[model samples]
Structure formats: structure tokens, C-alpha cells
Target: MNNFLAHTFTKKAFEQLASIRNQYSVSIYLPMYKKGKELNEGLGQSNLKSCLKKVHAVLVEYGYDKSSVNDYLKPIRNLIFELSFWRNPSEGLAIFLDKDKGMRCYKLPFPFEIKTYVADHFYLFPLLPLFHNNGIYYLLELSRDYVKLYKGSRNNFRDIPIKKIIPKQLEEVVGFDFEQKMLQYRTGHMMYPAGSFHGQGEGKEDEKKELLSFFRKINRGVTKMISDKKAPLILACTDELYPVYKKINSYHKLWDTNLSGDPEFKGTNELHKASWSLIQYYFETKKREKLAKFISKFHTSLTTCQLSEIIPAAVKGKIDTLFVQQKEDVFGTYNSAKGCLILDSYKEMRNISLLNMAAINTFLQGGNVYFLEAEEMPVKNIPMNALLRF
Candidate 1:
């Protein structure tokens, strides 16, 4: 089953969409203002938990319970929930989420940044570190869908045809069959069994030598993109191969941890952990500077301030990003203009609940939450703040 299948909830057919449509409004937020607290009573307003409750009411099967909200929502904060309503269209959802955070959620006139530089199907195989690398036929199907949806109709998000929309460019786009295309596949933790073959047992030095050679076979199999250092390579391997992969994380001047290892995927999650995979070559190195370059490339940022000092200065439009956590119980808006924000990331992290709200403020104003896979962000990893485009 596809990894996303667990998330796809099936509702009643035919009349289901109608009932849920009105139930799930496009915009909802748990105010940052604390419940029963005036805007002046505390630092922020209605919190994200309230907003997540509203989303839960709209999309999932559950009622909002204040006591349980925090525990339920804790996991979703640092992760990206890529949802495509089997019944609903993608544009409409993107529009809603984009609007919820008050983002510059504009639809592209065209994937103008991309030139349709079609690489041979085989060539697209190794770049599987970001997002799901599904069926080869499905990708071509996605291309066909893009041609149909994005090619015309003035490229409107809502009115454009979903049937025609094809996946467009982010920094980069590559294709591969997760099962058949890679030279090796290993576990994220163990790093063994590069595809159909397993390593041979040997004496201590020989075993180390063989393992090193194995990694070479895996890493040396770089595509033109990596060999020439055009864009970083996202490798595909199982969890077993991870230790081995990391042991040789520093190769002979060649490092490609852009390798994604999703054990859930049987391959490709570690290297692509978090939504970093979505970023094509963004977080691929151990070097402090190489990673800083990518994290600093974020398209959004949270605007923060001390309640006593900054609230007076934050005019409605002046603040670009506003963050709020899903279960946080905030009460009111700063003045009369802004709306509440919600963070529905379900995960664990260091003081992430606090960070989640800070992140929400960023989104409430139309910025995006820095979706992290793990709670503790590394010093070398992209700083949530650094990614802001502004």
C-alpha cells in the first residue's frame, strides 16, 4: 500500500463530498489569544489547537476536546501532511491552506521557472530522496496530468482543470521507480543489502574493506548530475544500509547523503527526512556552510516580538508571518485585523509546542510552517528562521 494510504480516510460515496464540503470550510484557525483571556491578558491570541480542532471537524472524524487536543496534535507540528482528497481537488486545498496562513499563495502563471528539460526516464531514477517516488507509469501519468491542468486556462488555481495539472518544478524534479531503479537499497539504520545483493561476511579488516567497497559501489554510481556536481543526488536505499552509508558519509571528496531513507518506504527517508526531500539538494551535506546555504534559502519567516515591546509596533500588514500551534489555547487577535492560526503537525521535538506557535504566527500571515521531521533541528540543518525569503 502507498504510504499515504494510511491518511486517506474513506467517506460515504456520492453524497459524501457534499456533506463534508460545508462542514470543512476553506479557512479555520485556533486563535493565538488564550481562551477566556483578552489580547492584553497574555502574550498572544487564540492558539492553533482551536484551529486544528476546526480542521479536524472539517476533514477528519472527531470532535474537539480541549483536554485531548494538545496530545492529539503534538505529532503533526513538525511534519508535512501531504494530503490529496481522493474526492477533493488539489488546487482547492492548496488555496485553503495557503489562505489559512495568509500566505502569498499565488498560483504560478506557468511553471515558468522550469523549461521542461526532460531527462530520459532512467536518468530520473536516483533523485528519490524527496517526497514519494511512486510508479514510473504514475510519474508519466503525473506529467500528462500536468500538461492537461497547468498548460492553459490562464493557470488559475481554483478554476483550472485538475485532470490536466502536472507536477511542476520546485528547485528540481526527478523521476524513479522506488522498487526497480536503484543500484542499491538499504535500511536507514543498518545499511545493508544494496538492492538484490547482501554483503559477504569476512575477517575484521576484510569485512571493513568489503563494506567500504560496497559503499563505493553505491556512491560511485553517481549520475551526471552528481559526477559533474550540477545538482545534488538523492540516493535510494533501505534502512539497513544507513549505518554503512553514514560511515562513509565523507567519501573521496564526494558526499551524497542526499540519499533519502524512509523505512516506511523500505528506502529513502533518512537523507530526505522532514520535507527536506521536497527541497531538491537543499540539505545534502555534513559541511556547516553547505547546509547553511540551503536552510537560509527558506521562502518564509516568522515575525516575532516581546508582547510589551513589539505589539504596539506590529501594524496588521507590517507582519508577514504569524505562527500558532494546533492545540495552543489562545484567545484574541492583536487588534482587530488578523486571524487565528493553527499548527496540525503531529510529531515530537524540543519545546516544539512553543516553536510550533511561533511557527504558526509565520503561517497565519500567509507564511509556511517549517515542516521538520524531527523535533530537534540540528545547528547545521536549515534554521526555520533562515529559510524566510524576506
Candidate 2:
């Protein structure tokens, strides 16, 4: 079985792409459908054909022999028949090919709009969403009969195999003996009912203490499993249980906002949608704080919105953080040797996006990029903005 959960867009993958110095590098981004006829085999083949047609045009324009180009793309063509690969679809797929690099493919956790970029170096900005999406978060659903754990991102959610480490039910951990013990406590120590279907010999306070003890045990196991992964954990349970869980939670990165109500009735899609809405605000607020600092230090020779100056600085590893409009594109070329930018009319360089180059270069140099709405940007007139390291 494939452990897709281990897949990550690592720094080594970025270095490999940045080092490719090929004459005809092809970058293809395809939106993948999870199911139906679109996912079976036909859609992947059709998309590859469409992308190849575009690549063929670029090769012809650059004066490459048709046979040589075909040979370079042959491995990619054969990948279309890998039924097992096609069956396990994520949100998107990216394919990079060249004469020297051969062909490499990545199944992304987030979807990309279908597009093709044929360039001298591999076009990499389309893969940024995998990094910028803040990766994954854990969701713990609590209840008497249905305690479940899930591994989730903004676009996908799946159950985590945690039954072995953490017990999934009250009976599994405390056993049926607690029921008779609770009745004894209630008859001897309490003057009123404990307010739920399940009861024993204890008062409400004692019962609550027992439940807290159970939750703390679960939390310790969960923390041990996810401590190395620093992703946020969100708790989903009833309103009454939320406070109890929060009080006992030892995980440092547990999200303040939680999924309230019983999660047993909720579908994966519904839970993911709600969780994403809350998590997005956390990401945006973090970006805003960084952007605000950039604005404050603009006069210290460490911040800029000038495309001409920022492009070369990004190439030299000076950028610390960047904020750019999500879908905006600018047509131009950069001369890395002399740190010069050559802007062209839209009719001249239709395929090259200078904005994408800036973002890609920044990421390659270990800088951060935030895709903000127009209103959220520090400057609305310029397409790019950055905070410099030096």
C-alpha cells in the first residue's frame, strides 16, 4: 500500500528543479478529478495529449527536431497507461520533463487549474500552493461510541489509523465496571441525576473528573504520535465537552477554534469545509502580521514593491517574505547576470510571467510567499512586494 500521507514538497525537490539547466524544459499542470469517468483513465490521457500539443508548438518555434522532442517525451507518454497511478488521484498532478532530467511527476494535495509552461528552466510557481496551503492539520472527534481521528488539509481529509494507540470508546478504556461504580457513587454521594444516559455511583463533579482522566490519557498518546509534526490539532465534540477537552489538552498547537457539535453525522467534506474556514483566518492573520512589519521597515532598505529591483534580489537570496496578488501575471524577462529586467508588450512575450519568476525564485532561495487578495496587499498598484533579508 502506498503511504501518500508521507508525501511533501520538500526543499530537496526545489533544489533539483532550480538546478535543471535544459534548453527545452516542459512544465505541465493538470487538475485531477477524484472519481467518475474523468478519473478512470480517459481524462488523464486527454490532458496529456492537450499539454503535448502545446509543448510541440514550443519545440517547433525553438527549432528543435520533432523526433528528438518525441524521444524526450516518450516516458511521459507511457505513464498514461499506469492504471494504478491514475486510480489514486489527489487534487492535482504536475509533470516536469527535459532531455537531461527525463520526466518527473508529483501528485499534489491541492488542485491546480490546467495549464502548460514551456521554458528554458522548469516553471515552478504552480507547485507553490502545496507549500502555501499550510500543509496538514489533525481533527479529533469525541463521543461515547464514535471517537475518530482524521488527517486533513484544506482540500482533503482522511481517517488516521489511531485505534491501536488511542482507545476509540469509553468502554474500551474504563470498561463496563465504571457503570456500576458510578451508580454506587450517585446513590451514596449525590442528591440529583448526573444529566446523561450513562451514570454510576459518583456525583457530577466526580464523573467529570473521571472523564477528564480519560481524555488526558488520550491526549498523551495523541501528543506522542504528532509531537514531531507541528501541525495544528482541532477538537470536534459537543459544546459541553469542548471546555473539558481544552482544559486537559497538552498539545501546544491545538487550534483555539473547534468544530462544535457531534461529528458522527457530518461527512468528510462538510467537516473539512468548516475546519478550513477557521484555519484560513489563522494563516491570513500570520501573513498580515509579517506584511505589517515589512511596511514598518520599508525605509530601512529592507522592503520594496519595485519589480525591477526585487527580481534580481530574489535570485541572490535576499528576500525574506513576499506578498503578491493570487492570479495576477506580468509579462517580462529577467537577466540574472546583470540584474536587469526587460519589460515587453503583451504581444511580444505572451508566455513569460515575471511575477511567477519572482515567486519561484523567492521560494527557491528559502523565502516565503503569501498570495493575498488585492485589498489585503500593502500596495494595490504594484503586482509584487517583498521584505528583504539584507
Candidate 3:
């Protein structure tokens, strides 16, 4: 039996979802319990059944006959009985399907509010957290005898094999000569020592020089492996080795803080937890800065809480940062040719979530999209806000 559930969701996947342009695309999101009684009792299966019912009703409203609707949703219907899928679930589930494309299901690491959206495009705002500055990072665990690399996100972390491109140890770069050189070095008094060699300062300098050569080799392979040079790289190593590696580190986004320990003993989960704690401050500060910029420019042409103005600007690629209230939907139809937006009081056959439109447009244009609670929104009572690029 094929599990049919995907555990990893990437930016590429999000882009694929955005690029889909089917008239009857269905997107369903549901929070799932990772363990305990809820999962044991098959609550996720029942929740999915409820969402399927809603989707069927919407498809019927779109003028699909009962037989066609059943055929269209057959893939999703099968999931309700896929026992293995419910047994190993993530914090949330997102399902996207259409008559032509069939279905794609992802077991996401974060929870979502129960939502069923059928529109011309997928409802993607719930997945914004995965792309925030807090989104993806690389961890390079360095030591004299060990080297490992990992790709990490908020709730997922796994080792990335580097043996093919990177040396597994200093000896791989320096050869057996490293053992002979090690005899000359001695630990210094500092808690995180940068060692000394036989009472001579030159010994410490030679050690630094050797480590610099080793790290430069590692940096070359790391740079080659990481295609996204802008993605932050966190170094997990002793305090002493940080400065040595920094001298030759060519990666522009290498984080300023080091994990500050013998990384060889720590598991991926522990490293992910510690690295996230260090880098989260960076994302928070960035969010604060954007909010402050919006507040400073509020009431001017540079900022807006108006959905009508925001929608057109988004289409034209004018948005710089967008803040949207979570669990809120603004249903409307937009005609790009006429630059018209019609807001409906309720969900209609032709209308889609205007907020989704704005968010996806802004994202595709290299703008930031942030989902905030009502209280966290920059302006009170507004469901959407934007900081314009202009």
C-alpha cells in the first residue's frame, strides 16, 4: 500500500501549487494530533470526511453532476480509509487536488485551522510560516576530528551527506601529517581554548593556519553544495574554532553566533533546537523593523490597510511586506485586465479569497507575507495591511 503522504514541503512545492491554474482546484487544511487519544481513535480520518463533504457541496454548486463530482474527489475519498496514513501523521495535513492534476498531500510540521477552500488557485497563506526568515537554515558541525552538515527548519532537521564533496575530518585534508602536528599543540588556559604549541606563540599561529586551510576546503565544498548562498549557515563548533573558520569562511550568510560546544555528541534535534533559538531573534528583529517601517509610513502613500488598493498593487509587484490576519478570509473576484475587485459578503461560485490572491502575488514577486493574529496586526480591525515597495 502506498502511503501517499509527503512529510517534506519545500519552496519548490509551494511554487508548484501557486503555478497551478485549474478552475475547480480544491485545497483542504486540517490540524492533526501527532499522538495520544485523538490519533488513536482515528479523529483525523473523521475530520477529513467532514472536509470532503464540504468540498462535494461546493463542487455541486459549481454545476458538477453527482457522478462527475465523485470521480473528481475519488483520490481524496480513498484517504479516509488509508489507515497507515492516520497512524503516522504530522502536526497538520494539506491536500490539493483538481480534476486534471489528481491529488497531492503533505504532512506538515505545523498545525492549521480547519479549512476547505475550492477556488481557481490553492489557498496557501497557512503555509507562510515555513518560508519566513525563520524558514530554512544549514548547520555545519565542525571539530578537529569530525565534520557533518545538516539542513534544518522549524520542526524538521536531517543530515545532509557531505562526504562526497567535503572532507569528513581535518586528516582528510591534511593527511597523516595532522597527527604529527597535533603532538606540538597543547590546550590553553581559556575555557574555549585556541591552543598553544610548546611555549611558543608561533605554535598557536601554525595551528590557526592549519585549521584555516582545513576550513577553507570545507567552505569550498559547502558553498558548492548550498545552491542558495543567501540561506543562513549556522556553525556548531567550539568557540575557539569559530574565529579560525571565520577567517576562511566564504559563505556570506554564515550566522554570527556559534553553537559553542562539541557538536559531535549532539543529535540533530538538539542542534536544531539550539540553532533555532539563536536565529529566531534575527527573524523577530526583522519583523519588528518591517512593522516599524509601516507605522512610520502609515497614512502616507507608502503604506495601506485597504484591500482594494493592496490587491492591484500586489498584481503589479509593488508590495514589499504584507501582514495578514490569521483565520480571516476576504472573498472577492479580481479581473486583472479591468483592474476590478468585487467583494462578496459571502463565498460565491466565482469569488476567491482576495487575501490569498494578494499574498500569493506578493510572494511570487519576491515580497514578504506574514500571517499575524488580530491583536498582532499593525493596524486594528484591518484584515490586511501592506508596506509598498515604492
Candidate 3 on 147-236: residue-level lDDT in tens? 998887677888898977998887787779887767554333322244222344665666667777788899999989886666789999
Model 2, CA-based lDDT: 0.75
Runs in model 2 deviating more than 4 A are 1-8, 34-47, 78-89, 133-136, 155-160, 178-206, 228-230, 297-300, 331-333, 346-353
How well does model 1 score by local distance difference test? Answer: 0.27
lDDT of each: 0.27, 0.75, 0.85
**Local accuracy of candidate 2 as per-residue lDDT tens digits, 164-275:** 7887766666778777756675685565533242445435655676677778878887887774467889888877677777888989998887788889999888888888
Please give each candidate's TM-score: 0.24, 0.80, 0.83
At residue 34, what lDDT does model 3 achieve?
Answer: 84
**How far off is model 2, as Cα RMSD?**
4.7
The residue-level lDDT of candidate 2 at 119 comes to: 68
Q: Report RMSD (Å) for each prediction in the order shown.
A: 19.7, 4.7, 3.8
Better of 1 and 2 by lDDT: 2
Give the Cα error of residue 234 in candidate 3, in Å. 1.9
**Against the correct fold, how does model 2 do in TM-score?**
0.80
